[model samples]
Target: MDDDGVVPLSGGVMKAVRLHQYEVRPLVEDVPEPVITHPFDVVVRVGGAGLCRTDLHIVEGQWAAKSNVALPYTLGHENAGWVHAVGSAVEHVQVGDAVILHPLATCGFCRACRAGDDVHCEAQAFPGIDTDGGMAELIKTSARSVVKLGKGVEPAAVAALADAGLTAYHAVKKAVPLLHPGTTCVVMGAGGLGHLGIQALRAMSATRIVVLDRNEEALALTRAWGADVTVVADGSHVATVLELTDGKGAEVVLDFVGERGAEHDSWAMTRRAGSDFVIGYGGTVDIPTIDVISTERNVVGNLVGSYNDLVELMVLAADGKVEMLTQTYPLDAVNDAMDDLDAGRLRGRGILVP
Candidate 1:
C-alpha cells in the first residue's frame, strides 16, 4: 500500500510534491506510484496539474480544519492525464485514453450522485484537498470521476478546466436564462475564472457583457474575450454600470472576487430582480431580509462543478470557443509556480507538467 493507504503501483517510487505540514510550503519528494485497488478504480499518468488559489489556502491553514486532511499528501486538484491502468470493473475508458478528472470522487449510490449533482455527495472525497491527488507522476481515481477528453483537446491545455473553468461555466450556466439580448450582465474580477465566464456568456447568450476589475490587464483580456464594456473596479464602477444599463442596473452580477467589499459593490449594481452569483470565497454575504423581499433578488453560491459539466466544458475547448491561457512549469518548479500565482505575476492558469 502507498502512504495514502491505497494500492501501490509496481514502478517503485515517483517524484511528487507533498504537504509535510499545515501552514508550510510543500516539498517535492519521491513517493510510491498509485495503483488500482477497488474493482472500479483507475490509475492515470498525470499530464498536467493546475495550480489554483485553493491550493494556496490549503498551505496557509485555511483549509486545514475544513478539509480535515492528514499531513504528507500530494496537493493538486485540477488534474488531467492519460489512463494508465484500470480495474476489471472499469469499462468505459481504456488504457492510454486522455482524460480530465472531476475534482470530487463521489459514490454513485448517494442521493446527490443519483440526481447528477455529485458535488454534494454524501460520501465524497476531494482530490488534493482530502486525499492524494495528481501532483504526483500517477494518481488513483474512481471511474466515475474520469471524463475522456474530446479530440483536438490535450490534457495539459485544458487541465485548468477541471476546476477554474468549470466553476465559471457552472455559474454562467445558471445565469444564462436570466440574461437575454437586451439584458445587461456584470462580471466582477476578470481573472482566470472571470475571463472564462466572459467567453461562456458570449457563447451561450447574447446579453451585453460588462466586466469590472482593478487590474488593467485583466480588463483588457476580458474585453478581448467579448465583454461589451469594461469598467475599472473603483468607487464609481457601479455607477458606470448603472449608466450603461440605462439607469436600471445590470440584470445579473457574477462576483468572482467576493473579498474586500467586492460583493457589496456587486450587489448594488444588481437590478431589482437580478441574481447575484458568488463564486470566489474569503468574504461573507450579508443582505438584509427586507431587501431580499422588496427586490426579490437572489444570492447564489457556486461550488465547483459536476462530471457532466466538465464534459460540456471540454466540448467548448475542442471547438475553440473557450481557451485557457496556461503557463507551463516542470514538476520540479511546483513551488515557483505557486509563488508566481500568489504574487499575482501569472496572467492565466499555471500548469505543472511531469
Candidate 2:
C-alpha cells in the first residue's frame, strides 16, 4: 500500500475473492483495500454485493479475450454500501451516507457523455471486470458513480438493482415510448435480470406485461411481481404470445436469454414494425436479411443503463413501487451461492454480505 496518510486510502486493508483462470473457482484472500485515485473519488464500506450471471460467464472465460481484466482480480459489479470516506474534491456525498454503486466509470469528456449517453462513453472502465470490485469490506468509487439510497431501501435489495435492475431499466425504457396502454410487452426469461425487467416495466409503463420462462417456479414468481401473463417457453410459445396479443403480435419484445431459439421466438412473436431488444450477453443468432427489410422490424442491443437511469430506478424502489427479491449469503459461502445460481436452485437473486 502507499503511504499517503489519507484516512481511506492509506493503511487500508480488506478481504476479497479473486479469479485466476477461466472455468476455475475463485479464491478468497486478504488484499489491500481500494483507495481514492482521483480528487472526486469516495470510499465505501460495502454492506452487500450481488452475484450476477455475468460473473458466472466471466468465470467460464467467455469474456476473457474481450475484457481487459487479468487474472487474480476481484469479481463483483452489483454493490451497495455506506460511505466510509470521501476525497477533498467530492461534494455530492459525505461520510456515513448510504449509497448504491454504479459499476461503469465513464469519461465525462467523451461524445457519448456530451449527449448524456454515458453508458456508451468512449472511455469506459467496468468495476469487477476491468478493475477491482466490491466483494470486499471497502471499495473506492467516483462520486458520479455513487447514487444515494433513499430512506427505507434495503441495502441488499439495492445491490441487486445496481446492474441487473439498471440494465433492465434501460432496455425496457427504450421500448416504453412505443408500448401504449393495453399493448403487450413480452419479456423472455424470468430469472435475475428478467424478473427485474418485469418489475421495471410495471413501474414505468402502462403496457400489459407477458413473461416467458422454461421454469415453472420462475414463471410463478413473475406473476407475483405483477406480470399480466406468464407462458412456458416451449416450441409453441410464439403462437401463445401472438394469440395473447390478439394475433397482431406483441408491440415490444425484450429477450433477456439471448439464446438461439429464444431469439427466433422473439422475432416471430413481434409485430411488423415492432422493436426487439436483446439485453443478455451470451449466445449467437442468425438474422435473415429479408425479415429485417420486408417487415421493418428493428433489432436493438442494449448495454447497462446510464447513471441517471440508475437514480430513477432507486426512486421507484424508494417509493415501494418495485420490489427487489433477493437472498443473502455470507461472503465465505460465495462458492455455494455460485453453485446455486448455476443449478437454478436459488429462487431469487443472491447477494454476498461481507
Candidate 3:
C-alpha cells in the first residue's frame, strides 16, 4: 500500500469481471489493480455499479464494429464510489469523498464540446465500452469524471442514476422545449431507462406522459412513477396511443427501446409534425422514404448526457425531484444480476455492490 493507504497497482490485484470473447460469459478473476496514469486521474474504491443493456450488447460483441474495443475487457458503465486516492493535480475531489463516476470522457477542445454538446465530441471514450470500467473493487478515472454525491441518497441507488437515470434525463430535457401543457409525450419501453424517463418528464415538463411497455409489471411501475397513462404492447397499441392523444398522436415520442418494432411504433405514435427521440441501443430500423417526407417527423439519436447534465441531474436527485429504483447484489452476484437484467426479471434497475 502507498502513503495514502491505496494499494499500489504495481504489486496489488483486484477482482474484475472481464470478457474474453464475444458471446461468452465474463469471468470474474483477480486482475492487476488500475493505476493513476494521468495527472488528473483518481482511483475510486467502488461501492456500487449498475448493470445496463449496453453492457450485454458489448459482452455479446454487437458493438465491435462501432466501438473498436478489444477482447478481454472489463465491463460496467454506471458506478459510484468513495475516492481511494487522487493524483497531485486533482483538486475538486479528495480521498474518502463519495462520488458518482461519469462514464464518458470527452475531448474538451472539440467543436461540439465548445458548443456545450460534449456528448457528441469528436473524440469520446466511454467507460466499460471503450475502456475498462467499475465492475470491480477499484477503478481509475479522471477527476473530471467524478461528481460528488449529495446527502440522503444511497450509493447503490445512485449507481443506477449515473447512466440509466442520466441518459433518460438528457432525452427528456431535449423534448422539454417541444412539450407544452396540453401536449402528450410518449415513452416506449418501461424498463430501466424508460421508467426513469417517465419520472424525468414528470419532474421537468408539464406534458401528459404516456408509457408503453410489453410487461404488465413495468407498466405498473411506470404509473407509480407519475405517468398519466400506461399502454401495454399489443396489436392495438397504436390505437390506444391515438385514443390517448385524441386521434392527433403524441407530440413527442421517446423510444427507449430502439428495436425495429419499437422504432416503428414510435413513428406510428408521433403526430404528423412531432419529434421522435431514439435513446436505446438494441436494433436498427429501415423507414420508408415516404414516411419521412409525408409526415415531416424528426428523428434524433440521443447519446448519453454530458458531465454538466449529470451534475444537474444530481441536483434534482438531491432535491428529491427524481427517484432511483434499484435492487442490490454483492459483487459475487454480478452474473445473477446480468441474468436478471437479460431476462427482464428485475422490476427496476440492478446494481452490483462491492
Candidate 4:
C-alpha cells in the first residue's frame, strides 16, 4: 500500500448482475472487478446491494430517456460495503472501513452540492442508473460519497438506508416543522420506504400517524412501528382516512405508493390547505386545476437525499431508532430478490449480499 492510500490491484474478476437488454431479467455474469482509477476513487467490497422497485422500472424501460444509461451495466444502487481500496488523495475512509454509499457521485463545488443538496449537483454521476453500480463483488465510488459505519454495525443491515431510508427521512424531515402535536399525518403504504417513513415520523415528531396499506400484514407492522391508526387501502380508504381525521383530512399525506390509484386517494385524504408529499414514482398526479387552486394544497417532490441527511440517518440507525426490515439473498440469487419485489412478496427491503 502507498502512503497516499493507493493500494495495488490484483487484476481479478468477480460476479456482477448485468442487464443486457430491457424488459428482460438480468443475469449474474463474471465481470472485471472494480479498481481505483482516479485520485478520488474508492472501490468498495460490496456487502449488500439493495433491490429497489426502480430497478424493475429500469428493466421495463421506464428510465431509458431520463437516465440514458447504456445497457449491459450493473444494477444495484442502494449499496454499502467496506473500502477494499482507495486512490492516492482519498483519506476520509481507509481500506477495510465499513461504509454506506450516497448513490450519487457529485462535483463538490456545484451550487447544489455546496448547499448540501448533492442530489441535484450540477455534475453528478448516478451509479446503477447511468453507470456501473454496486450489484457486483466490488464497486467504484468517490470518497465524498462514502459514510463510515459504527462499530458492530453491518453494512448489509443498513445498505437500503443509503437510498430508501434516506429518501424517506429526507421527505419526513422536510415536514417535521409542520408535524405539530395534534396534527394528523397519513402515510400511504407500509412497504420498504413507507415503513421507514413511519419510524422517522415516530422518532422525530409528535404528530399522530395513520398508515394505509393494501396488505393487512403491512398494516400490522405499521402498528408495531408506532402508527396511531391503520387502514386497509381499497376504494374505501379515502373515506376511512377522512373519518379518522374528523371528516376533514390529514395535514400531511405521504404517498409512498404513487401508482395504482394511490395518488388520487392520497390527494383526496389531504387537508384542504395541507401538503401532499409524493415519494414514489411511475404515476402521474392528475388533480384538476380547480382542485389545486381552491384547495391551496402543496404537492412536493423528493429526491434520494443529501450527504448530511445520510449522516444523520446513520446516527439514528446506530442508536436503534430506525431499522429497515430486510430479506437477504446471495448475489447469485439476485433475480429471486427482484422476483419477490415484483410479486409484492417482500415484507421489507430485499438485500443482495455479494
Candidate 5:
C-alpha cells in the first residue's frame, strides 16, 4: 500500500464492468485493482461475481435515491473468490483462502450485529449497491464479510450464494420453526431467489414445499429441487394452493415477486396466523386492514443474510444440499449477461468470471 491509500497495481489496470450512467448498460473498462484501505479490509481476487436483478434496478435508477451510491462504480453483489491481500488487522482469513462475501460490510459491535442480525447493522455498506463491488478482477471487502468455503467447494460454484442464496437461506431459516412434516410452505415466484428458497427450505425443514411461477420450466426446476407441489402462477393459483392445503392455505408464503398482484395472491394463500415473508420488491402490497386484524397474520421483510448466515449456508452448499444453476460469462460479456437476465432468458443466476 502507498501513502495515498492506493496499492500499486502490478499490471497497472484490470478489467471491470462499471455503471457509468443510470438507466444504461454497464460498461466494461480497464480500472485500477482494489487495495486494502482500512486495517480490517481485504482484497479478493474475483473468481465469480453473480449478476443479480438488483443490478438492473440500480442501472435503472430504482435504487439511486436509496443507496445514494456515486456514479461509475462496478456492480456485482454476489461475490466469491480467493483472498489476494489482507489488511494488518485481518486474521481469520489470509491470502490464498477461497471465500464468499456477505453483501453488507458491517460493524460487528452493533447491537444487531451482536445478536447475529448483521443485516440490520446500524451502519453498513452494501457492496455493488452502496459501494464499488466485484464485477471485476479484484474487489475490496472487510474482514467481517468474508466466509471461508469448505473442502470441494469452488468459488464459482457457490458465488451466487453470496447474496441470492444467503437471502433465501435467511428467509427459510426464519420459517423453519413454523414448519413441520405436514405443514405447507409456499414459495411464490420460482425465479433465482425463489428456486434457491425452495432448496433451502428442503435442506432445513420437512415442510411440504409448494412453488408458484409463471414459467412452467421454473416450476419444474423447483420440483426437482424438492418442491412438494408446483402451481402455475395464473390468477387461479391462489385458489389452487388453498385447495391443496384443504382450504387452510399454506402455513407460510414467501413472496419473491411481490409484484403484479402476486402480493394479493401470496396473502390469499397464507393460512390464518401464518407468516408472509417478502423478499423481492418492485410492486405495491395492498391489503385490507380487516384481514390483518382477523387473521392475525405476520408480515415480515427479509433482507440478505448475515456473515454467520453465509457460513451456515456455505455448509449446505459444500454438502451439495443447495446448488446454484450458474450461467457463466466472461467479464467482458457482462452486457450480454445482463441482457439475458433482463429478458428472462437465463435459466439460473448469471456468474461473471475473470
Candidate 6:
C-alpha cells in the first residue's frame, strides 16, 4: 500500500516545485492534484507555503536518510490556503474556508494523539517532508490538521506560523515557568524562527528578552519587536550574554540556530539550573558529564507544535499579539527564494504562493 496519507491521486494536474535530486535545484513542474481518498482527507487550494532552513537542509541531503523521502517530492512544510474540498467525515472545515495546516498529519487514535501531544503520534506523516507538500496549486491533508483563519487574516501572511512560528511558540510555551518576572531569557538567532520566539516570549511572560544574531538587521528587527537587548553574534556573544544577565547568565535560553557552534553557546548562556531549549536542528550537543550534574542545566529538544499549539498561536495572531515579517514569491520563483534563505539574505520568512 502507499504510505499513509499519500494515496493515489484521483485525477487532474497542478503546478508544483519538486526536488528531483540532492545538491540540485528544484524545478516548478506540473504534478497530480490532490483529491479526497479517505473519510478524513481534505484538499486545500494552495495559497502559500513557507520556505525554511529545513527545506535547505532537505535540498542538501541532510534529511535524506532521516526523512526517507523519495526523491522528487514536493518540498514545503509550512502551509496555509483555502479549503477546496472535504472528506465525508470531516466536519471542522469546509469548502472556501481559509485555514493553516499543522505540519504533520497524525492518527487520532495514537497514544500521543490522545494526550494532545500529536507531534509524536506513532502513525504521523510529515507533509512537505516525506510526502507531497502544499507548494503547489492544491494539496491534501487530514481534517485534524486544518485551523480555520479568522477574518482579516490572509493565508500567505501567516502561513509560516504553521511551522516556524509554531515551533518557537511551542518552545517558549514550555519555558514559561522559567520566565517569570525578573528572570532573563536569551534568544539566539533573530531569524525566521527566533523572531517569533521573541514575540511569543514577550506576549506570554514578563521576562526581559535579550537577542543575539549574526545579522545586524535581524538584531534591529528583533529589538523593534520587543527584545530588551540585541547583541551582534561576534566572537564574544557568550560573554556579552553573560554580561547582560549580570554575569549569572539567562534563566532560559532559546537556540533557534543550532549549528556552527551555536549549540555550545546556547548551553553556555544558560544560568545554572536554567533550561536551554533547542529548536533548530543539524547540530551536535556535547557537554561534560560532570557539568550536567553540577550545574543542573536542562537541555530541552523541541519539535513542531501540536494541533492545539497551532490553535493557541492563531489566537495570539488574531489578537494582534503576534506578527512575523514575511516576504512572498510566486511558486515559479522557488529557486530564488531558496537561494535567499541559504545566503541569509531574506530578512524574514519567505513564502511561495501558487
Q: Give per-residue CA lDDT, model 1, range 1-354, as digits (tens).
A: 644455644656899989999778999999988867677889889999999888888898888888898898999999999999997778999999999999989999989999999989999999899999889898899999999988666899988899999999999998999987899999998877888888988999999998999888878777678899899877889889989988878899999888889989888889899889999877788888999999999898999989899889888888889999889999999989989988878877999999
Clashes of each: 0, 0, 0, 0, 1, 0
Which pairs of residues clash in candidate 3, taking residues 3 or more apart in a chain or in different chains? none
Top candidate (lDDT): 4
Tens-digit per-residue lDDT, 74-192, candidate 6: 98999999999887778988799999999999999989999999999999999989999988988899999999999878999999999999999999999998888999998999999
Against the unseen true structure, what C-alpha lDDT does each candidate score?
A: 0.89, 0.86, 0.86, 0.92, 0.88, 0.91
**Steric clash pairs (candidate 5):** 23-59
lDDT by residue (121-179, candidate 3, tens digit) is 89878878888889999988878788988765567779878899889999998899999
Q: Candidate 4 lDDT, tens digit per residue, 71-92?
A: 8999989999999998888889
Q: How accurate locally is residue 76 in candidate 6, as Cα lDDT from 0 to 100?
A: 90
Per-residue alpha-carbon lDDT of candidate 5 for residues 1-354, written as tens digits (9 for 90 to 100): 766465544545889888989978989999888766678889999999998988888998999999888888989999999999987778999899999998899998889989988899999888899999999999998899999887667898889899989998999998899998889999988887887888889999999988898889877788779988888887888889999999999889999887778887888888899999998888788778999999999888988987888888888887888989989999989989989998888887999999
Q: Compute each candidate's TM-score over C-alphas.
A: 0.95, 0.95, 0.95, 0.97, 0.95, 0.96
Candidate 5 overall Cα lDDT vs. reference?
Answer: 0.88
Which of the two, 1 or 6, has more TM-score? 6
Residue 41, model 4, lDDT: 91
Off by over 4 Å in 1: 1-11
Worst 10 residues of 6 by lDDT: 1-10
* Leading candidate by TM-score: 4
